[model samples]
Target chain A: MSTIGEYIASHAEMLEAALIQSLPPQWNVPVSLRESMNYSLMAGGKRLRPILVLAAAEALGGSQAAALPAALAIEMVHTYSLVHDDLPAMDNDDYRRGKLTNHKVYGEAMAILAGDALLTHAFYSITQCHKVHGIPAERVLSITEELAAYAGARGMVGGQAADMLGEQGLTKLEELEYIHLHKTSDLIVFSLRAGAHIAGATTAQLAALTDFGNAIGLAFQIQDDILDIIGDEKKLGKPVKSDEKQQKVTYPYFIGLEASELKVKELTEQAKKALLQGGFANPERLLQLADYLMQRDH
Target chain B: MSTIGEYIASHAEMLEAALIQSLPPQWNVPVSLRESMNYSLMAGGKRLRPILVLAAAEALGGSQAAALPAALAIEMVHTYSLVHDDLPAMDNDDYRRGKLTNHKVYGEAMAILAGDALLTHAFYSITQCHKVHGIPAERVLSITEELAAYAGARGMVGGQAADMLGEQGLTKLEELEYIHLHKTSDLIVFSLRAGAHIAGATTAQLAALTDFGNAIGLAFQIQDDILDIIGDEKKLGKPVKSDEKQQKVTYPYFIGLEASELKVKELTEQAKKALLQGGFANPERLLQLADYLMQRDH
Candidate 1:
């Protein structure tokens, strides 16, 4: 692995540990609800969102500790979305990450509540971070506002709605782009932008990070689509052909595999360029992240 | 209605208008999620939670506008809990306030997402309120922390879990009290306490209001239990006797209806006394609220 990749992998392991440790105590939740939240949140995945926050903060000359809460908050929000997405009425997936989805394990009611709890707790987490770092309350509030906007109706939820509604037929490239941008890209953008904002980034730097995040987020989704069709079920830790079975529209379905791959390459390059313009002299880690995202086996 | 009651009712009406008018534009959420959130939020209730915040603030000699956002935040959190509770897995209720529950109308996925959105947005609202009121950032951060603790696992969610588990059988009065104290009473207490905090309530006043809130909240729950057994469905505007159908444990179930009614009366008296001790001479509105809780047909 490249040096930056190695660093991210190690950092991700630590971040995951922190996340699991931070989960609501079993005593605090119904036994069933606690089990369900753990089922999804503790399920092993690359801590991509949190890693993005850490990486962005690091790139901006901020300490990882300074960004830890933002990292945790982003992951919490992301996990919440995933938990809700796997519910019977949404993606209806029975299995995720090689195990039963939250609703299947906890029942629908607890699963719903678990997601709500996580989302609410995320903001709670962010506020606590504000306290610890002595970050100006206005800046913390600004970040909260930005994070809410991106993760809420206009951003991720909106994308999921369009995805569900648009499931009936093959979608155009523009529609697919809209879905990726809102669903996948918005939080990713927020994660990076929040890190920079917390670290007192200049307006121009914030704008650049936004562009970089947007490109990488879309590219990440495109790669995910490509993997679903070609990835190994055992390695992917879930069913490979499930999206196809559900007839969900994806970048590969619209642009063909080769075209999607090309788009991923193009977006990766653009993300790198944005990072460069944003005065990231030590772009090694971020560049490796883009490469690793595009080339992941699962 | 008494003059204070008339004032509360009128002010609550105004708060309701502000809530409706203040909903972030539909464009902020995807059309589907937007429809679901609005359906439940705009479906009218007495606006008791927000009104409590306003009254508490006014009583403490703060401007009502200073408390509006906090009031709105409390309602959003309360509404989110309701949406999640009515999901298929939780209470599995089909209707609330005589209208279809969020999941039933919007489908479970959107309902879940909508609830998550509302909870997250609540903090954003509070922060924005602080900004508008020019409250110190540290104060805003502290308020957010207080709000989170009350709403999160140790507060409302914990109560919910106990209520759900206790539904199987809560034979003791204390167990029922524990459940209500956490689930129903904590937020009510938080609502009053948070308002008092924002208004710079004296330490003595804060302690008294906290006591007052705790007494009334339990009384409120006890009255709800009484209504479930004795209330008219048409007047309640929703299903009555649902506790029996759901096999849920309640105050009346443990203490008997007559004892529960007596408890409500006692609690109301305690609440009024606490308010008086807190130096609230104009306890007119609070007394009316206590009475309304015990005597309302609905």
Candidate 2:
């Protein structure tokens, strides 16, 4: 049996190919804008969000081929948020995934446009599920609606706004939790849900996956915070204490590093419990994946 | 019988109400972001795009109610492009429609978030058509796809990118026309197509409307260029000759003013001819709108 690491790596390679296939570099207009979008998109990462999408589909007995577009769309949305968040007006980061950020290589205007293109293209790309994979129009529409909501005003973007507003200082645990829940978890949750939706998971099964998703998503961010303190900079491909440099509040700062690490363990156990309810052909991979994420080093 | 002007006014009023209803002021998380979106959205203008959507639906002998969500979606898209275009990194405008621009009122981060919110909300709004007006899931899906294509990377956003890149100045008339055709006309064309799609227009009829839309939309931009030179500031509700200040390449700047005006007249005639072939319930009204747009000062 393949280990969880191999499962993730295999899925990530498939996702990378799909993403490149989805966005052609040969569009007539927005030539440079398209290149800018490709720049950050092609930059390597774990591809965790998209991997979750495919894994959920497989657990529900769905082929990765059938679920690929939805998976790509979710990743595109994730990528767009990162690009925009790195803008000068936002997080203003200079690097991402061990490379210069989108704005650093492309001009600010082009980076902004690149982000907009990816976000908008996420919608356009998903519509192809009906065309390419013969997914029903109603299902595609439902996905589109859910994607718009989670990624837009009330979810991820709203979380970013709160994070930006609180950058000077956030004292309340609730406020920081809100940021972690919405900014980071919304899309992660969406990716899991979208995969199940493509695989025709029952309402109960979907609920289980959603619960699993939310728990693991929080745990992932907590691990990220933990990494920012104790992680190897070379392995992480970013500065360890950059979050501190930003003067932003974090889980470690609020609850202490030990408590934050404890929270990751708690959330990981909760995710395993949820997946126990999400009955499927082979949920072992998913359960293993949860364990792996909780103990992730980089 | 209501004149074309009265017809437009009636549609605009309904559109205003629908716009307000579609975007509630009460999204709690993105409070300031939602407010920034509402700020420019509620700032009064002619509401031409939504009106055209309704008009095209009516021309196809369909209920305006069926097309209303799409109309509102298009308006949201237009508003988003405006908010972003006015950003500090872009046009850097302080005013829009006689009021402070979103960035000026809400700060740059909020304005950017607002634009992102509005753009995402557009898709969410249109999904309601199936539930609210009994528009079929397939038809709504088609509209969603077209809107995504035209308003996104290949269309409106692409145009905006081209316009920004040419801020130093575009020399060729073709370059200026490319900017005008994509930036200004893409959404307008989408509005016309959306109304037709909702009404189930025949292939020939849809093609004719698209032709008319392309012509009239480009002409609208040309007239806008003329207005920048000769328009009343109080009436237009913004600074005049600001395009010159931005060093933007305008139709009047590329060609002599006389030739530019001549092109508008020619495009207006071509639009009327397209409407002639369109075979609608009241092509006369569309023709009148074309002529009015050609001659409008503001």
Candidate 3:
């Protein structure tokens, strides 16, 4: 593709097809359960995490077909997190992406189970990397372990727990960074690493990608906070400044908006530097992706 | 170890220690998240599933050291299910095993995240089969896939969904059986198969154990239904006839108490016969455990 947008568009098509094909057959799952899972999985988002998986793999000379399952798996994990986070017990969001949230559409019970089913099935989907896509079992095992570590108690869930606890009155900058680093960055890191592992990247290369992912993940979050404060309301969808309305502590809350923007630039530059030094055959797309994320308004 | 009770006592102690040790160190996990998980995990159940993993491995001449991680993993999955099942939007229970339910103590949000953390960590725990316990990578992969299958949409979650939908008024025996088979039997079957895979049991032996697991799982459910009606309240740790009080359609509700008891006996016999024909090196403990389950009043 000539542009990052084109690259995302084409890869998203394939990712959508792969996601549908990857679901267990209707006969195998309960009708309502399958419906609830599909409602969330098919809900439109940026599709950034899975696309990162595909781009990272392609950049490392891995075939898209080989990385497709991991791509879908990461998206499933993301979808499950969203589903749970939108529950009445959590953020209690009624809508996401202009549609009813999972718990709002389905009852809380089914939504809870659907989120769970999605989480568990994500691992099952990853196993297909070995079972169907000809990836080595050891590589698949490593990917599975990486996913569990990044998504489990000490990673995304821990970040969420900390964030929730922080919401009660804590205002430390370190705690906010911890939450952002884990709740947002860990899965992004996992996506890149999973794809790189599929391509048999060396330790040095994986470390480089980890640096790239961490930098861009933080940049992405900071940019999101900046947009929430200053971006066009219509383009962004929903209202801007919702964070300020809720008195939520964000990057801009601790640091001024100009500083937050400068930090995003610094992190994006750091990410590009890591990729340039990693000696990959095709880092162009990943470089473009980091820029696309940094500059996007929505 | 001469009796099933003694065998269970010793195995329970070992399983308890393993469960605690298998947890990510306190420093690695968030304090409150760890506390929520530990609360439910240590609240105590029969520890039946993990013990079964140990016993099955022993039957096939595999060491307990090799099976312990898988044992810990299955119990984590079981504990997570209970934590979510007790949520206000689900069963709405305030207590379990004489302790406050997870949501009751930690609040609904933490309870949900804690359950999510436990479920994710279960897969992480299973990966230790190869990492710490020296089981083959391929075996660990298989065990992980089996866990996702038996616990995911097509298995326990599917069963829970069906049971919830059925409570709207459907009372067919077939539907009830479908719910019980998937919800109860799948995990039991996975427990046996995980141990068998660790032991390097042949496909035939795995199939035989599956049959044994299915028979006992259903029989065990029936026994639960029967006990809910005809057993002592104090021994059972809850009121007797609670299912009847709720008008829940259980085995005895549909088949009559006499037929349900008869079905339990026949299923137990079938389970024993499968073990006898399976050519395990030692089936003594599993056999005694089955009979012990059959004869238990509480």
Top TM-score model: 3
* lDDT tens readout by residue for model 2, B168-233: 778798888888888988888888888888888888888898899899999999999999998889
For all candidates, state DockQ relative to the true structure.
0.61, 0.75, 0.86
Candidate 2 runs further than 4 Å off = B24-27, B282-285
Give the alpha carbon lDDT tens digit for every residue of B1-298 in model 1. Answer: 4564577679778877776655577455567777777777787788888878877877777777887888888988899899988877787889888888898888877787778777876787787667788766666676687787778766788778778767778778888888888888889888887777677777898788888888999999988888889888988777888888888777887778898889999998999888888875345666677777767664
Q: What is the lDDT of residue A172 in candidate 2?
A: 92
Top of the candidates by DockQ: 3
The candidate that achieves the highest lDDT relative to the unseen native structure: 3
- How far out, in Å, is residue B208 in model 3? 0.3
Q: Which scores greater on TM-score, model 1 or model 3?
A: 3
**Worst lDDT 10-window in candidate 3 chain A:** A18-27
Per-residue lDDT tens digits for candidate 3, residues A1-298, read: 4788888888888788777766767547888889999888888777899999988898899987888889999999999999999898998888776789998888999999999999999999899899888898888999999999999888899999998888865577788888888899999999999999899888988999999999999999899889989988777665778767877799988989999999999999999999887899899899999999999984
lDDT of 2 by residue, A82-199 (tens): 8888888887889887899998998787887888878888888778778688878887788888898888888899899989888889989889888888888889888888877878
Candidate RMSDs in Å, in order, are: 2.4, 1.8, 1.3
Per-candidate chain B TM: 0.94, 0.95, 0.97
> Cα deviation of A41 in candidate 3 (Å)?
0.5
